[model samples]
Target chain A: MNSQNVFMGENLQELTVHGKKEFPIQYYADELFRLPGCQFPLHWHTEIEFFAARGGSIKAQIGRLEFLLEEGDGVFVNSNVLHSFSQLRPEDRCRCPNVVFSGELIAPADHLIYQKYIGPLLSSRQLPCVILKPSIPWQNSILSCLDRLFSLMQKHALKEERRPLPLLSFDSPADDIPCWEMQVQNELNRIWQLLISHAGEIPPVNIEKGEASLQIRMQKMLAFIRSHYASPVSLDEIAASASISKSEASRCFQAYMNQPPVSYLLDFRLEKAKQLLSSTPDTVEEISRKCGFRSSGYFCRIFKRRTGASPNQYRRETT
Target chain B: MNSQNVFMGENLQELTVHGKKEFPIQYYADELFRLPGCQFPLHWHTEIEFFAARGGSIKAQIGRLEFLLEEGDGVFVNSNVLHSFSQLRPEDRCRCPNVVFSGELIAPADHLIYQKYIGPLLSSRQLPCVILKPSIPWQNSILSCLDRLFSLMQKHALKEERRPLPLLSFDSPADDIPCWEMQVQNELNRIWQLLISHAGEIPPVNIEKGEASLQIRMQKMLAFIRSHYASPVSLDEIAASASISKSEASRCFQAYMNQPPVSYLLDFRLEKAKQLLSSTPDTVEEISRKCGFRSSGYFCRIFKRRTGASPNQYRRETT
Candidate 1:
């Protein structure tokens, strides 16, 4: 938080531009919104950050490049890179649970296991950044470890802050906390034990059954539109496939799929047309026919309006 | 590319995997496919992978979860995460240019600079997994470094792979070809130069201007649909804001955006209704009105069709 140290142990605390937190480990979880949206602006400090967006989208700009992030995706930004986040839409926004403990907060480098794996990976890449999407089988273990790390940090925080408390025993002062580091180490052991336990068994199915049903419907709809969109197909036709009425189809389409029947059909057609345009090097007229567009001029207008570039321009730029 | 040990030396003289190449150093750039429509199976390896989706949509399933990746979005799947990828649409698939080199491939760990930063972060967190989205300013640099790494890898591959007929030198028998390790080292130097030069600058903008325009339009369209879908918003209303004609708008909606106008609007409305139905303890009729559905019967039908479970069931399960 200060010039000498942007992040200091709360007991040996210092505060700065990132705002203030009195906790032992300044938890970034509750305060992530301060950065807002998904992208983070140019900024760097000595604190190590753990970022995970379980749902939604995130984009970060570090220098000139921008990196798009999706749910269950995250990256480790070494203290060296200046970075910032851009806000995302309400629908697109996601909650990324993370904790930031100063790099200097834990035991020295020699004691950590991450050094064996993460250490070499980071060093070999020569990249100031490391991005990660923990696989499902690894998610629980990873999250559990992080959760423990947070608790450990919290435990230490209490000791550092020396919060006043009444003692049960008549021995020693009530203000003193029992061995905090040992507790944290125990937490780390529990996390490791959980990870070892869940090493390879198939990951748990977390999406609800109803959500699964909706997902199935979405796939069916997508397949149907991809196959029959070019030819005339009505809402009723698609609905019949899902064994539902036209109106019912409309509601399902909106909630989980993000588009209704007719709209999805159009998307299928347009996407097909774009494929022809980008890969085949075909003319607008030719692509229109292949994509089920009736008129060449109409197709060109559509391509331009949607893509902000003519078919020809898109091909040229890409090729 | 070998498992046990990767040997890098002069191009010609190589045999055993672990056997060191005679020359000082050797660099090889393996050509990664740039297929826009190809899909890779779920897999993992010991080496670190840098994945970048240049265009369209790519969904990767690692562990138990699925991630929908767009352009410029990437995930670092550490070793042991079982993963697979699929192209949502033939045209929606794109190539990712990545550099794969071993920790032993570059400098020894002791001399690496990045090790200094990552060591502290990992040891401090004691986390089993960490995901990060770099802030702006840092993104560009990381991207540029990756870009340079890939470029150098390619150039090195060429030098190692191609050898012009050796000039007739009056030295020993023609079998003696001087080691190309020096050449590879030189190439690595060139890569380092590029990285150093661009280290202070923003990384390359991976998304094309045209692509950004389309994305911006998509963002606006999404906002419009979210805001006005409740009432009745025509195709004209959506297209007008994006500055396109109705038919053209349809194409835009279909293409990159992945849905048609009315259908998307309807879908959005229905989804809102579903959320309300599940979250709020409201009458079905009230929920229907809140979600823009006309009648309870219609809402029920749509909900049932989209979700095999009725609204009530969904609410119960969710609650």
Candidate 2:
């Protein structure tokens, strides 16, 4: 698997244990170029993330909300929100600079800063993500900060290459101070302050007990789907995995995923089949069965409708 | 107030509040290019720091221990250890890449990573600083990690300048993920792990109660000196502020700073006088009095011996 793809396992609830246990900040600069009809799969992590489009336009999905970010546009994903991105045009490549860091980088839970700002935003259900449009004053401020930070990081790297290799010595200087690192830390804090202050203007998401429980159920159902995607699955089984009624499962998926349970299952199966088609030389009948499709004819019909291409064609073009 | 100079006030104890209230990770990258006799003043901060020599050689003093660091040499300063730096030669210009961050960045107080590794190393009296020389395998590994991290930071920054700005829209796709951020986080973690594992190899420092109390008293005396540096102060008053005997104060200064209390005071006064001479147009007599010198003749004598020039000549040359 490409390291660029953050998804590690079949599960949608991604436990993104970023960095090592001692260091928890994660950073990535990825150029995402997708063929038309190809979608990055949905997954969620506890780390807060910022995704900025570097070239062309891309569509980002945070929960059920969709945002179309053109070049220079960006978005912030709050912790544990289901989100993904896709290139808007088949012919255009979408390059994005993305950063994901543990909220602990902002403040520890016991600290006043965490309690006053970061805690409220993280716990709030309504502000799961914020769209950073360059046109909006506050959002534009954030984009500029992000841009400056990225540039500084680049300068630091360039300096390393241009500088001579250090010689070894046992004598450590006591007056060595890190001025650039301080600048980076200051910039990140400024960005956080902007986000925390703006979070106050947005209405709090009133999450009812029933709604909260439903979200948990949906997560459980999604996990079930991921694990059983290649096997024969049904709405009854999905609902049973979450200990919810079949109707409730279907309603929950429809509400959050904007698709019925069976439709989601079918789409997931088709996505798996498409992957198999491109990566493996399995016959259509074998691929269809392996991906939980009943027959090659039905698989072809659904794949064509969703991807605008037959399974064989997708494989040939993408491969 | 050159930004490169980390010293903010006259107090020897620097309570470096890094980042913001909500974030406390302070970072700085300072390049030290000094003429012979130029020195970064002695100071201590609660934050931990890493200093890597980029070019030439410099002398670093931490507490009573002094080390001559050649290019590529680095050192880690544990929390609250007095340290200073000076250029090794009149013609040499030393460029160092230094990083200072809160120990909290490694792990919060409640975190196991802190309790198991960071906390012990920080609170230990013996491990106030560690010299990182390329000749030592573990230290060399740490230097390599630091180099990699710096390079990665540069890459992230450069990517921003190389890419075009993003445009905004509401139709977000589901495929954009940050891969580079993850890479950075991973590298930082690797560095932390190496540090933690190697920390066990060093012996624990045994601190005596008398020595600890002497340090506290010295801090009090230093604070008093900062507050009264511009006044007609004496050794008796400085010792009285810390409720210690004058001889004891002198002994403590000699032990830790490698100078008598009065000598430290004179050097400090001369440093202040130099700053005033260059920045303000006050007459030499007035500036000498303001810096707590008894007479212009004595001040000129000390300044010439220390800085290799008379007050008027130094001001004219520097200005």
Candidate 3:
């Protein structure tokens, strides 16, 4: 990926679409311990997402809100909200299976059902994220539907990404895929209505001016780092791109992303180096210098420590 | 139900809504032999409908088309199509479970999903009704969804006529209801997409100017009968209402409705008497007079023979 173009030239908003436009959803069975640094980086997209913690506890940080979601518990993160999840303890060995989807999967924006029930809930200043638990009845219903939804996706949805699920047509000749599209839709509808019914009790997220602007500033800084990750990136330059002081940029990252600005820069650099190693036949020293690392030895140490594999080992396994 | 009003007098359109407007759908587990005269008269409504025959064979007459649908066989009637079901043979005991719903129940008219997919199919001149048999794979998929939908409705929907199924609300406090709304919607969506995929294989019903006019003339004649059934309607007047000869009118009725005009009037009269018997304090003679039967004794005989109950016995049992 070209660093400047792939970063969208400081467009700031995350450009990764969760699923295909026709039937927009991506079902994930994520093992947290398997991910880099035992956590995926904080990112925000236009699509909404739901994460159900499984096997062990995990801490979900959405915007400025942070909470522990245990097994049998889940969380709903609203659209355009920056969020991340990580193990509660370093060795938690958690699994957090989830789905990320555009709202259009359930109802188009012009639909009456969307206008009456869905629009208000989505645009409300109060609900950036809602934590779900089995103790509550309505929340339990939502979680139960999520469970059923995951199972439905696992059963019928092909492992291939971005293709339309073989829901109805005999064209693809996958007989195991029954009429799953509609069944999954039915579960989603129930979950949405459950959220509607509890709109009042869920506290407002306080995405007032201060928090919203902080998120914008954070995005600009991240965009700057992404565009410049192939070269040396400093906190001073990142802060200058967002027109904020270096300390303010650090505060913005900490507030919305639950990490410091330098830590993010390091992660981005390491991520870019891994991409180069996997996609290109470049030497280790060449990749390390191109990814803004001080030395190939330091790069290899950090890569092995974070990913539990040497660069050559990763390339061999993946290639 | 008033005779003139219940008949929707000269409107020619059936006015009985299958379900509520907000969430429109009505489910029926119809035992064919229990229905008067072993059939319902030809009726046309704007909403679409689906029926799966169980236990024995029954013939479906849709517009000018007629076919036998056996157990594990189903049919889909498009919007505004006139259709009816009857025992293939009088002794063939059968149960035809079905759902009647407006197109809006599946997708709002303005949605892209509706405009791109659902609208074309419902308004297709080629597909008045589709027969589904378990022998074909795609057809069997649709039939399986119908089976699943019926079972979902049976489990989650209250026995009440028009109430919204207990889809998500805890307000009504029925503990057994789960998230069934989306599951049923999923099945319906798959069924719709299957029809779309098989659009080429399905033959158009030849609803050309000739056939369309035949249906219109038939409707006008039925409307005439609906308006005048309680006042001793004659075949001649029925023919004159739509400016056709008596024989042409009989042919039109048989061609579209699968029965003669006099039989329609007779069944309609019996239907009116049954309503009056159940809803009014009138004596059997009074109902017979109101429904334009020749005499109370003649009315009683016809009612007992058609419905397996005398007028007085039906009234007493119902009241």
Candidate 4:
């Protein structure tokens, strides 16, 4: 929320831990109507995510596969998968809850329990995401678990302001639950037992590894450009981050971000220049240098072109 | 289940990882009437355990705090705490479900979420165990979570023999949950949120650190004697494991196991010999050396005295 843009890391990782180190999971509910494009852009995190469109319809894409998540329907994304969510009708309401968690919370990586059961699904190259419809039985059972899990999140989120939950410590009698810790673990293990037992039966997504990795490298190129924008970031440096030729890097930027490398860099620099003008007391020359422009005159011309106002005028009006 | 004895480790730790390293939780149901003397002897585990008596009343002691766990009631034992459970009446059936888990499952130890909310209750020397009855509201909520959790365990345990669970990956959709991974983590976090909110009101147990450490030392001593039984483990070594005098060590063995240290060691060696006699082709002299009985004559005399049969006769009958 703090960053104005969706910032992927240089290695194309989301870099957020997702949840606590112990039980890697986190909950989120978003209204797409408020977002810049009524969608979260293409980004990949190592943690698997469950995205549900709770209100109206939404468009989702995992790798090259694109589909609409009908209201009340959800999708299960695999780890290291590139995915995005958007409102089908951004003019109206489109709300969603994204639940992200690591597979490790179900089982450890080293154990045979994990390898024999959980690992196959995560590392399956043939599958990237699964669409869950309520009409199906086994999928419905999975949805039911998720319903309880997320509904609890909604309820807790609502009550969090007023409630100080009961701790397990009991010197005298308090009204807290006695053994919830046991129940959560038990439920999760059982849920895993249900999922892995029928993994082979589910149809494959047929998504290619190369296509996914291409988006990943594209993201790395974007991240490299974003981070080094204040310095004189080059086409060579951007290409090297994703390990591609310079022309291939330009082609990636044009394909994914709809701009050539230099244009995107200029847009990024202009955005930063505007931010600095409003937030800092630096002079025009200092701000230009800080934003990676070789000359203040060039910076002023680009700033006027992008915003129809000089940096100082834009800052003055905004402030 | 594989080992015939309750094996603690040399560091006074129970080395079992409990559940998968990712989750660190496991479930067990025991019938105390089936156990020796209708009781599980005193042992300290680093993981926290929830001991609930489902069928009959049972005696439970966490650290110095000893009490009865009435039928339909449960107790929460903190980590690294010494605790024991036994039937209040050995003649009748006593069934219990013991849910053991690491605190990491709630939140990682290093996080502020864990330190501020969960850690205080765990590291508090004044608290060891909390008793939970059905009458208290908050405590009942805690028990409800446990009930649901354990009920799922019992249900899954039953279905596990027959049902194959659905995997999340769906190409043709034979039916699996789309987002169960999200739910499990969501549920666990919500459960933690509820637990920590009411911690301050729970009464302290007043169990001293010195007393808990004594049980800890006693356990290390027992583990030392058990692991080194095949060698010439002396009283000095046993005493040193617990950092106590030889007389004090002897007293602990007598108090806890209801025997002197040497007597317990002899019984253990004989048990090992009996197992080897039936399982292996080792001669009496080799068995004697392995059991640390000093000589075949002494080993034979002790074996006969305890089992009322010669080593060969016992081996013949058992085999």
Candidate 5:
């Protein structure tokens, strides 16, 4: 595989494991082993994930907690809880990106992922969502489970060689459940099975259920801005869509997020620009266009202001 | 002493070395023994500091650079650059916090603190900001420099006790430069020299050239909300105090921050309430009032919807 493609890949939709379809989910050693220095954004998938530092250490941030993982230590993040990971250590040997896929490569419901796993994890502050240094026994068992899950995923992928359609289904319910690593494994596997058995559709987003108020309307507006951040969005258009007066929309937004809606849009665009700069060798004009800046000059100015270095200087320094 | 107060202690006015009132400069270390597991936040003081971790590993985010502090590794951050640090390995010990105070602290412009050390370090992208393990010859010298600097600062603190008044009254230019640590033992000896020379007073918050928008008005609004969240904060009142038209203020806020000003207020309040529920032993009603919720019932409904758990349930589960 081209190493550069791994870093600069844009078609995030088509990633797969072995032969079976890959959906974002729980931790597997194989996936981690497959790619080195991989990173993911702050997001939640339909499957629970445990992050472990195999060789060196990895830093995982979930909500307020930040975990610095040593070898054999792991943090189990439940489904639909926002999280991000990075490995910024020098002595690390196994620097493969750690990610697990939810079983919903066949069918998915975002809510099930959240309700069953994330809800429980979040509700139970008792179980440190951010855990480190598991007992040797527990670590070995968890590692074994991860290996088996990886093998199973590989087996499903191998089936594609024999049958272009659905692969041979495993019958035993005992076999259906992935072996227990932690108590969470059972629920995690169950949700995975559900998602796997019925994967192939986008889940509905959450709806705000409250009295019709200016604030509630504003939340919808904010969500819209987040969803359409990649595209060119306008205040009048957003105001009309959110069914509020332009002035009122602007007012409500400023009061909540601290900046004007347009300014937020600009900031978000600039953030994307910075990301592209570091991760990809995209040109200033291209980045600006992608980020919806009206002019490269404006983009450069904002970029420099936000980050002391210019876009080009930053790209050169990092890349 | 309250452990939690470690972060806010003494209002450490400026960075110093050996308590002498001079500008802060970066120190390079060749052994991890002196600087291990140095975890710090991304904040800058008047002085610029550089830290090179030797024979140990660290991970630091210096501005945009996510540095892997390998042996002989170092990263130099500009004064007031917000950054954070974490240990990379189990063996790495915590490094002491580094600071770079302003040249205006005691010395003249073009002083060694800013010119000789930081100049070369900042410009060189090839040099690792943090060293993991330094080569043989450079290690001893670097360690000695750091060790002496530490002792010098300690000595300077001692001077503060013996001579509280007229502390900066040393007459001779020769006395201005001492041979305590490194090359600038003289400047390092001016412990509280600037503060002692001038009467006790906080420097006015000046608008620095090329500084980002003060964010003063926004901060004031947020602070007001935080302090009096339980009380009513009308849009007109907030706008009047901030010196902006209510509509303009709201629009500016929304355009920049993405949420309506009101929703932001609600969310910030709710977030605090959630934290209190998790961290403190307060009752739901008490938390509700403290968090600015209209009533316990309203708080419960909103809390449940936002967090998928009741306040009591959340508290119980978290605690």
Candidate 6:
């Protein structure tokens, strides 16, 4: 009944069903300007996501690859892919109109549209995300459909103007639902048609059998770091969480993330510290310790090196 | 050697080869503002075309279907599809950055990308043209690639800035050819990837055996009408051109074009008359007779009804 922000924490995004147990589509149009650091923390969802950049350049990280999308650009993140977004420029706010929907919206398991097109794309390991830029013909066609859908959904939301925006919860339609729902479905199907046609062209990255397992291991390590970032964590401890040797963990992180486990851990802590510095009224020393920094002096040094501002200065400026 | 506009006449465009035998690709970037009525007449090319609307709304007709593309909108006209471009609003001159490249540019017939992706698309009877609106995600991506290619090609072309403009004849060897040609090829391949991914989604319009034959008949009728529209033509004479009965020809026209055979002929004649009126110094009587109208009075009445202008008025306004 109400628009709920699905907190995507891990790899498998458990989509929140609205009315029925089987319904699997969720639409969220959120302004990243309102979020801390204007970013969504790295997470993956089971539902495919269509993220359109309304304004400013948005940086999107899908799996291990990252893309900088300018205004009017969009990216389609395939299901169960690790992805996140941040404003390219910190000062400029970005709004992403997103549609996270299950593949079932277009076709059932037996349908030709699904078996022929949607199945291959959702199952592709190589195509983690497709960046939609306005200059390319097919990509532009998909974006056009998305823009229309976003505008229609936005208009409908504005008309209701409820306290908590109504989650697109398509199954339980209120009596006063806007007539544009059919248009939204049509546009989505059009996008699916485009996706299916070009799905094969996305060269399948020869993901060796070991690569998937390694990705899962790296994912586990990431989850561990996320859960225990506030505690003093070591490379060995992170490796132990995934039942791998420290060197293997280091190698896995380097292979997938282009960073060592320790560096990723430190960066995660710094991000958490930055969030705390802006959101909480805690003193710099307390915040540093809370974010797993050994000392406020060391945290300040790393924070400035990463964010171009000291803890006090960042807090002051943001506040 | 020199920038040449490949005069696309009728349906099967026998591409004009320049400087070499069997040149596979021909590229032209032409501004329609300087041309009379700011439009390119109905024609089709064997090579695929990526037309990006630079400014204003451009109206494109592919086969019997028409689409209005706004600035920043692009359309991909599939190989050998009868298509034409015109300024949607005659007063507003539209600049189209066009790339007419053969399928060979991306992959040879024996190559996997061509065999798997390009071959099916070029040979598909169902897909005539794909209109790339900037709002669609995948299409937007292709358009983005095209825009970059156009800019790069434009920059390269500008360096020479010679009279008659140079055709993007890729076979010739120049010191700087490799640099920009590689960029062009890269961008085109990028476009192909987006295209091949989405091409399958365009459902094969179940085209029954009867329907496919009818389409071929209709295409032949169209070609015949195009060649013979200038002279006094009758429904029987047009029908004979495609070796079909008069009633069958009428039925085919109604089915495919949604108009009667005579009505289509009259409309085609009127279009010719309009072109002659604006482009030449011919009198209304002379142009009407040349375009197959029985009388100037009848031509004036039909022209006014279709275009909301008398022959002299239309000429004055356009000129």
- Number of the top-ranking candidate, with DockQ as the measure: 4
lDDT of 2 by residue, B108-183 (tens): 6665446656677688787877778898898888887766544543344235434221221111221222233333
Worst 10 residues of 3 chain B by lDDT: B166-175
Residue A303 accuracy (lDDT) in model 1: 75
lDDT of 4 by residue, B75-124 (tens): 87887777678898867776676667776665556544456556776776
TM-score of each: 0.24, 0.50, 0.59, 0.68, 0.29, 0.41
Candidates 1 and 3 compared by lDDT, better number: 3
TM-score of chain A, cand. 4: 0.75
Interface RMSD of each: 20.2, 11.5, 5.4, 8.3, 30.8, 18.0
TM-score of chain B of each: 0.40, 0.76, 0.82, 0.76, 0.41, 0.66
The model with the greater TM-score, 4 or 6, is 4
Which regions of candidate 6 fall more than 4 Å away from where they truly are? A1-42, A53-61, A66-73, A84-96, A107-120, A133-136, A157-177, A201-210, A280-289, A295-316, B1-319
Tens-digit lDDT track of model 1 for A1-319 = 1111221112111233331221123434322333323334233444555555544666655323456756556555544343444445555534454554433222223422234322332332134444445565455455555555554444444345463321111111222223333333333334333333443343332333454355445445544655565566788888887676788788877754346878756655666676666668677777777767768788788778877888888878767
Displacement of residue A23 (Cα, Å) in model 3 is: 1.6
**RMSD to true structure for each model, in Å:** 37.9, 16.4, 10.2, 8.1, 33.3, 19.6
What lDDT tens digits, residue by residue, belong to model 3 across residues B154-249?
A: 555545445433232111232243335545565677788788777777756656567767877887887787777778788899999999999999
The Cα RMSD of model 6 versus the native structure comes to 19.6
Question: Between candidates 1 and 4, which one is better according to DockQ?
Answer: 4
> Which docking band does candidate 6 fall into?
incorrect
Model 1 earns a TM-score of 0.24
